[model samples]
Target: MSDSVTSVEAPEIVVPEGVRLEPERLLDLYWYMLLNRRLEERLVNLYRQGKVIGGVYRSLGQEAESVGTAYALEARDYVSPLIRNLGSILVKGAEPVDILKQYMAKGTGPSRGKDLNIHFGDLSKGFIGPVSMLGDMIPVMAGVALGNRMQGKDSVCLVYIGDGGFSTGASHEGWNFICAQRLPVILVAEDNCYAYSTPTDRQMGNRNMVDRAVGYGCAGVQVDGNDVLRCWHAASEAVSRARSGGGPTLIEVKTYRRKGHAEHDDQRYVPPGELDTWEAKDPVARYERWLLSEEIVDRSQLDQIENRVRAKLDAAVDEAEKAPMPEARTALDGVWSTPRWTAEHPNFHDFAAEIGS
Candidate 1:
């Protein structure tokens, strides 16, 4: 994983029809995927070197789950990324330099160094920063969708959660609320087969997460999480239906976590041969091979694109490294806001004065 991105193309790979993207768009997708992989690898190195300010999480084998669903979204659509959805964040208008800065806790990061390690979001880009709790973002996402509905906008919100989060009280509460309201939301279960070290078998009695959707009366579809095009198609349909008058959709993407839960996790609980099996299905490599064999891109062109991405990421790291730290006094900023009740209740001012004392 420390080595640079590989351009090795798998033999005998064929993409199913209708989901094939144009050559230029396919190249862009590859660029974004490569960027994410490289950036995460760099983060791991930084973590090992004790430079990263906090725990580092990598998308690793699940790039397609994020990139594909994000690719299906429009500029006006909303996304809430979990810890492992770096590809989705990058695709949703977050600059690599900004992300690196965030991890490095630089003053110039999205949170202005108020937080560390992927805890920031830019709502202007239609991305909601994730909450620390595993499944809390689901309800927040539903609220965003409800707001879109109230405004009569066609925007739909896509939120990602892990398999472990599937059983969480917040997950159930959020999904139930979204379903009951018929909100414009797409719930993506990135079933990586494990919640931390615990396998899905130990976590839930129902292995089929999409079937849980039937209870909510929303459309549910499962896909080959490693197949970027398939994931994209499923997400596209869900997004389209949600944007229209139709309702929410629950998409289950079956994938595996090739690494531990985070940089700190050693993953001793994983059984032998499991990693190898999922590694063979590496989505980025599969997409690269399909693009090469189908003549969508030649070897040299793909190499050039990768080289460009490598250079860009290197420059981003350098820029982030040079950024200054945030001033201590700045911590007081952005943590508080005026509450509606302050203006609504005349006696609230007296209560505020009493607390101030």
Candidate 2:
């Protein structure tokens, strides 16, 4: 990465024709999105109930985009999500209980009882945590994949960033390195069309995020992110290419963050009827339609799947609650990076003291 950017092959992965209509997978997308949305709603209710503290990210409208992209990954693969990509984390096998535990500031949480307020780092289930800072994680994800390559393991890294993040220096630097090194990273620009109160029309001088990939010298594409199947097909291809040593792929999924920016945001800048427009192409509804249209599964079958998700979530919450809190000193531990942690450094810093275990 000693460079000014150099050219590489335009990454192109073959998207299997007609995969958008896969019934079982399509319905699973619905269940994943619903579980994330519903659980998030519940968390919000609890946050108000004083059961939880600090801010939270909700996956209301962006469920399909995150879940669909994540469904394409294998279990050993890593997904680095932005704070808002709740659905992405969930799709990566992060259970509702794991999230709830963190919200509750329970010791069972991956970060332990400290810094309970910040949604940062959970290594147990392949998620490193949601970076509150935008676009900072892109290079790190690339480095993770590179490290895996060094180890001769077949893990891939999925770096999920927002459209707003694309404007950052980190995005440019990360993209440059990713291309130069030819890392097998998947750069997912979850474009829900707004960077906080600012719209994409204002921030992006260039129309397509995928277009940025051209300069990076890797393959890129965009999808109708609302259609879960469409997103899935595109992402599945990108992931497969990555697995096959096809270098990196940039995916700009056209999506929207349905809710206000965050719990504290009033969202006055949201254009009238904008949410309604996106909602019509809702991923859950679209995926469900595909499922039924294909006769892949019936309502009862879908219900059974939903029931299992519910049960899993329920049990996870209980487990998290009962999980022992990381000792107050735990944070003081693991400070000095070791070889096994052997990845690059200058990224680690402690906010543990501020949160107070």
Give the number of the best model, judged by TM-score: 1
Query: Candidate 1 at 182: error in angstroms?
Result: 1.5
Cα-lDDT of candidate 1: 0.83
Error of 2 at 19 (Å): 2.0
The C-alpha TM-scores of every prediction are: 0.89, 0.82
RMSD of 1: 7.0
Tens digits of lDDT, candidate 2, 63-108: 8778888888888888988777778777777668767888888766
Model 1: CA > 4 A from native? 1-17, 337-357
Off by over 4 Å in 2: 1-23, 117-124, 314-357
Model 2 gets an lDDT of: 0.73
Candidate 2: residue 108 Cα off by (Å): 2.4
